[model samples]
Target: MEVRTPWQALTRPLAYPRSVWPWRSAGYLASSVVTGLPALVVLAVLVLFSVLLVGLPLLLLAGVALGGVERRRLRIAEVAPAADPHRVPDVPGLGAWLRVRAREQATWRELAYAVLHATVLWPLDLLAIAVCLGLPAALLSAPVRLALDRQETKVVKAYLVTSYPQAFAAALLGAVLLLALLYPLAALAGARAALTRALLAPRETELRDRIGEVTRSRARLVDAFEAERRRIERDLHDGAQQRLVALTMTLGLARLDAPPGSPLGDQLAKAHDEAGQVLTELRELIHGIHPQVLADFGLGAALADAADRSAVPVDTDLDLPRLPTAIESAAYFAGCEALANIGKHSGATKARLTARYDPGPARLTLLVQDDGRGGADPDRGSGLTGLADRIAVLDGTLTISSPSGGPTLIRVEIPCPPPSA
Candidate 1:
């Protein structure tokens, strides 16, 4: 079962008190007064002594301690565990941990929260509890006071209760008042918990850092995937390709040595032709996996080769410097996919590929345009979706402009630093 916080409890009218939320709220607020006073005094003394520089670490230590306390107290009102925004120290040592904590915004936020809790928020919490619980308790004691004193009793030191009936009526009114005040107390507690969360929760910078880490992880995965592809291509080219070449050569020699009309000679000829066809297909498959041309001569040459192989006549205007391996691979493959799409789907006779690198911006752009029926949709299994995803891993963009007429254009841009020789 999911536990609801005091704030969430307030939304459910009947369920708030039936659960432990009201008592938790009262306890949460009451404890703040207990914890905040000592923290306030320590913080003040440390701030006064901070000119000596010895107080800096002491103040940070006090704040760290208070942060732990506040997070625990928060669970009294908030069932959800509070997130700790502090990063672990990159180097593992006491000095390193202190240095990292001192630099973090969370440390400063915790300090500020400690100061506010001590100086301001706790007093409000005490006042709220007093009004909600104390006054009601005092009023509810009127019947007992009347019985013990055997005369008139005062309810809440104001209203006089002379008879048993009046004393019981005052007690009943106090009970109703107590019930009414519980809601406000819960609201106050919820607001205090929310304030604590706002101050101590992860900031925008931390979220951005998390996003950057995820992107780096994704880039690593892409690098590993590309490495595996290259390894497979290398194995095929060096091992199986060599064996097939030797086999084809031997069969050719045997066919030439045998007499022309013999059945053995004809069989040798057929076997040789079949072996040659299989070798050609295997080489094409290897190139499609991870082309040797892309690895050897870089993206420009690889793109030119891909364009030459396209069934549609493709004109090329490519100028590039050596780029990071990942960037080169992504750009080359994206270009190849675009050309293949143009050949297979676009009923155009001509296509053009233009590529350029801008060193100032550290960006490479490739544009493939075809004079074909131009209604390319990646959702229709056009093969561009995978290419787009591959390019996106490099923080690159792939765009297509293909209206339902003629002339489709695909553009890809990737950010990459020039490779050092």
Candidate 2:
């Protein structure tokens, strides 16, 4: 029985079953002999060292240690180890190096596998080698005849029956029986190797862990949005709203008590006008935080308003397949931020905003592009960050590109309606 290549310990477990492979037993038996021969030679040498007084105790300890290492390697280093194969990638800094100290948990087991290999592999190999070679030799040797009684010599001369046809039949029978034994034996070896591979091999756990981290990160983003919303509500009610009310009262009292031509009265009126301008700006800032216009007139109206408010001329290409409240809000905010960035950084004189929907998968795309001075940096605290966060909470994506010179583009893609919402 022979095999083409020496399979890695990890791969052996996944090999084709013997029932499906006529040659599997032969190959497996061949492989065992191929691997086990060296293992036995080493084992014999180690045992010899153990017989010497000075080296005896040390050899015994080393043999035991080698056995442990092999078993541990089988369990943890294999391609499909049942447990986590990731040992170093997850940990950072010198902590990864420290993981080696956990050897007692991992190394000992591998050594056991090595020791077991030493004891069992050679026997299996020898059995396969003996049957495979001896049976064929015996069957072929039957054809040769000697003198009177016809003695054949393989060892001490033995009287032999020399009819070529009969000898062929007997040899053929021996070969058949040996082949039959191989069928089940190879299956048994492959199955055993598979078990070892599963227990000792490594698996890719990092990718799954990274996905989990992204999911948690998205959840936190949603929590952050709600927190900011609470903050904005507090600012509007307690600071800006209260100040505007006081300014209005003061201006009204001045107008009622003073003559129109008086310098003092005129000055108070001027002060009132300035206060109104300040209030207007505050109101616009609050609106930027969350547009109430979208709730009243739908996404189209809110988006039109955003385009109208842009410092640069904005061309609108918005046509909706009609969107739900959450999607509408996401699209509105995304457009508003993109336009804001264009006005603030992009030097392009002309810009366009477009929106569209596809119902098959139920999705929407919003594009804001400008041919201005270009070079917009999303990292430098642009309104784009908030827009991205808003879309992400809805399980959407935000992409931006602004090369130096004259063009900047921002695209937001959101699932038509988020599952949770």
Candidate 3:
């Protein structure tokens, strides 16, 4: 793949490779270096002559534009480094625009970018243009001169050199050296631009800020997950588990006193049956909160159980090794949600679920497909949103494709598996 870096895109293209004219190349490089400088000088000159131009109004409007430019510059700086893009704000009216410009740090940064855009980019452009074109022109000059003049095998000039052999050697050497410099100079200019943006802008601070935000988000997700789990555990243990245990004891006692098929025995059996039903529902509820199977049997088993519970006939195709609880939980839960969505809304008869681990990509991907009237819109439900959050915790991705027809597919890719332990 050909990768053109942000700095190279902005700077080098202006001068180099535009035309092969040697003097023009030199002039381009010179112009590139001076581009940002001239902008800065103009801004400064304008500041001094603001009153003369249109008093305070022109300076104020210029300042607003300068602010927008500064914001744009910062956004560029951040993105140019593969960092977060702090986009420029759209300020609607003149008053809003003025306010945005006046109130933003980004504005100043953008103005500085414009100024540096001229100062730094111009010279590099000039240099690149000069080196790329001038040496070739100098080398090729003797040949063209030979053809145009066609005077002799040897020609006399005010300088000491005259032989065709000497001219050929000189021209060839110059061309080789010129071409040799191209890559290194291009690389250096690119590096210099990166360094320049880092130094001139607040990219370092912005990176730190983005890192901190990501950390906080992760922490919040962890805390929230734990809190939800604890709440569910409390409900199951105190409310349902306790009730089921009592019912079991009661049934054991009733079984001892009563004989089979008697009226009293039948009544006790009915209560006993009710207890089991409640127990099953409670288990389902607890699993819904956070599947204990995910902890015990890993991702594959949990999804299998989900498929079993699903009302629709599910064809499960899954093969996976034991994975960490977190990864298994995310995968299992994501699958569960997708399948649950399919069961609830999909009117088709056949549904299929598959989970496979790709060790090479280091991803655990799951697919839930249904031959149903597929019209699942994420906008209408929180199930997909919560699934998104779960996968995001693992830095994974989720995608659903459900046209309003007979087939629907839900695909989830967890890029990095959780800690193996």
**lDDT of every predicted structure (CA atoms):** 0.88, 0.62, 0.65
Task: For residues 198-297, write the lDDT of model 1, one tens digit per residue.
Answer: 8876556457667878998998998899899899999999999999999999999999999999999999999999999999999999999889888999
For candidate 2, give the lDDT. Answer: 0.62
What local lDDT does model 2 show for residue 367? 87
lDDT of 3 at 339: 77
Candidates' RMSD to native: 9.2, 21.6, 20.3
Q: What's the candidate order when arranged by decreasing lDDT?
A: 1, 3, 2
Candidate 1 lDDT for residue 66: 90
lDDT of 3: 0.65
Q: Per-prediction TM-score, please?
A: 0.56, 0.44, 0.46
Residue 128's lDDT in candidate 1: 90
**Which sections of candidate 3 miss by over 4 Å?**
1-201, 216-220, 223-243, 251-274, 417-421
The best-first sequence of candidates by TM-score reads: 1, 3, 2
Off by over 4 Å in 1: 1-200, 203-212, 359-362, 417-421
**What's the true lDDT of residue 389 in model 1?**
91
lDDT of 3 at 141: 68
Better of 1 and 3 by lDDT: 1
